[model samples]
Target chain A: MRKISAEKIIAVISRLCIQSNCQINEDLITSLKHARGKEQGRARMVLASILKNIKIAQREKLPVCQDTGMAIVFLEIGDKLKIDLGEFLSLSALVQEGVRRGYQSGYLRKSIVEPLSRVNTEDNTPAIIREKIVAGNRLKIKLLIKGFGAENMAKTSMLRPDAGEAGIKRFTLDSVKKAGSHPCPPMVIGIGIGGTMQKAVSLAEEALLEPVKSKRAYFRGCPGLKSKIKRLEEELLREINQLNIGPAGLGGETTALSVKIKTFPTHIAGLPVAVNISCWANRHQEIIL
Target chain B: MKTKRIFAPLTSEGIKKLETGDEVLLSGIIYTARDAAHQRMTKNLKKLPFDLKGQIIYYTGPTPPSPGKIIGSCGPTTSYRMDPYTPSLLKLGLKGTIGKGERSQEVKEAIKRYSAVYFIAFGGCGALYSQFIKKTTLIAYLDLGCESILKLEVEDFPLLVGIDACGRDIYQQQKT
Candidate 1:
């Protein structure tokens, strides 16, 4: 078993937290510019200006988008990991330490509050991490910092088994319509199908981490699954863009740039569907070591 | 449409010239308080902590500041979350409010009643927004930490007026 230093994990995630708060993945920029080409009217111009701002923020070492989202951590651990659960706490103290350090050092805005009290901690720390133990020797980490603007607009439904594909499509369309201009147009969509309620949410989030290109590491893990999900995603992408939500929810054809679906075998009693909407800036990156 | 620059710590005249659909670039003093502050502001029977008259309030709870910086990556939170307490603040003679997302009808009606406007400075552009905020100070509610009311001095901040006093909401105009 190779030794992995605890401090090293803490340090890397710290930098990642700050970097996620500062820079958006360049892939999202490319996708957005492509979407911009497909749009018209004020929506198109809004996208054009957004492109300009992205450049400005990058050159100046500033955050690419506003609404510096709440911090989310995805951890992939390997077997024979030597870290003590006793040291890990109920969750991991190191993770929270990274959040505290990252947000404070990076000057990221803190957004957590005493839930009901609604007080802001302003550190943006006390982040959320979802971790799993998988077949591996090294650790992998991904930060998909999510802003409230887009997160607030996410919707999910527990569809009846007989709802069928047509019903699914109609529900998806209705949800987007109800969301309308709120989630910020030109959104990246993650559709989760065929899972339990909570699992569906996880699947949607997992799908968001997939690469904008056709080949995705997350999807690669499960053999023969890509083509099936890929077709559904592209079809949904076409339908959502047709809605004309545009950039910033202004009317136009490019409301959604791309849609990716992730499915899991669920109990026959439930067919849960969830939509995880992300704004134009798909600010996420992964490190698999 | 062409945009014009205006200063915050707004005046009655500043409030008047602004109409629905007019884009504005604001400078001068601004304040930030999110959901918690709204609750307390509405809950207290006592006098409010600040002279809210003619002040612009930004509905945001930014990232904490790094070493030596005045504030963190600051951007607007959703406006609708604070809708419940907005009418009372408007009646207290506040100039304007900035936030991301939309507002409720009650707040809109209160805005019309008080002749105040709502502006937006981009939803997730925290890094961009922080650049305009030249300085910041904790004004009140220290117990609340980041939710504590903050006094921010800004310059050349760009925004679009989402709602105007004459009973017009740009979102409403856009929808109809």
Candidate 2:
């Protein structure tokens, strides 16, 4: 069994928190550049400003956005791997410690607040963590810094099974139209369909972890099901971009850079759909051990 | 597009000159306030840490600056959340506000009523905005951390007129 210390995990996560916030992913950068090429007028200017901001953030080791966002940690642990929990009660506690340390040391913003009291947590702690066990003896950690601007735009619906593909497309388009420029388009849209409400939401978020140009073969399903999901993603991307929301919602043909959909078998009576919109920044990183 | 250059502590005459879709480069002093500070200021209007007259308030909560920097990544937060508190501030002679996204119909009307303006900094372009901020001084609500009210001296901070004093709103104009 491969043994990993909790302290090591904490240290790695701490560094990742800082690194992910400062660095713009290469794929996202490429997508933005491509979008910029296609945009004109105010939309083009907005994309240019976004690209400049990314450069400055990287050079100065600064956050790309002021809203440093809530830290979401995704863990996929191998069944054969052993974790030395050390003094921590659970893996989550260690991860939280790492996030707290990282945010403080990196000068990232502490955005988490008490829901009712509205008091700032001051440490950016209580990170949202999702864990899964896998067959291999490798542990993978992925972090997504989810800002609330786009997160607030997320929507979900329990559509009738008959709503099917067309219904899903309409709901997504309507959501994007209502969102307009609020979520900071060009957006990366994640669509989750065919599951319980909570599961659908979770799946949508999971889909966001994939790179903007990722091949849609990561999820387990029959080939027919996979092709259908891929086709839906392409169609949604094209339709959403046609919304003319553009970059910064000022108007253009690049409202959405990518639309990714993840699905699961659902009860015959319900077709739960959730849409999670991510702003252009789309900050995230992953590590494997 | 020709970008107009403007300064803060905006006067009625200067604001009147702006129109929806005007690209602007703003300089001079502005105050920063986000959700927490807005809540506190609106709740105790008379006890505000700074005067509202002719001052521009930026709806932002910046990251803490790294060593040797004046400020950290700073950009506009969504403006809609401040809609409820805005009319009151506008009434108190708040000349303008800086943020991203749309405002409510009421707030847009209030802007015209008060002869003020609403400017939009490029959303998510925090690092770019930070370069324009030459200095930052804490004004109030220190306990709020990043949400604390701050007096920021900015130079050529890029922005667009989202809602001009005449009540022309770029967001509404851009809608299909």
lDDT: which candidate is best? 2
Give a tens-digit lDDT track for model 2, residues B77-129.
Answer: 98888999999999988999999888999999999999999999888999989
Residue B85 CA displacement from its true place in model 1, Å? 1.1
lDDT of 2 by residue, A87-171 (tens): 9998889999999999999999998988998788989998999999999888899999999999999999999989989999999
Instruction: Evaluate every candidate with DockQ and list the scores.
Output: 0.41, 0.87
For TM-score, the strongest prediction is: 2
How well does candidate 2 score on lDDT at residue B152?
97
TM-score of 1: 0.89
Report the Cα lDDT for residue A211, model 1.
73
Recovered share of real interface contacts in candidate 1: 0.38
List where candidate 2 sits over 4 angstroms from the true fold.
Answer: A218-222
A94-120 in candidate 1: lDDT tens per residue? Answer: 878778787667656566765765656
Measured against the true structure, the TM-scores of the candidates, in listed sequence, are 0.89, 0.98
Instruction: Please report how far candidate 1 places residue A7 from its true position, in Å.
Output: 1.3
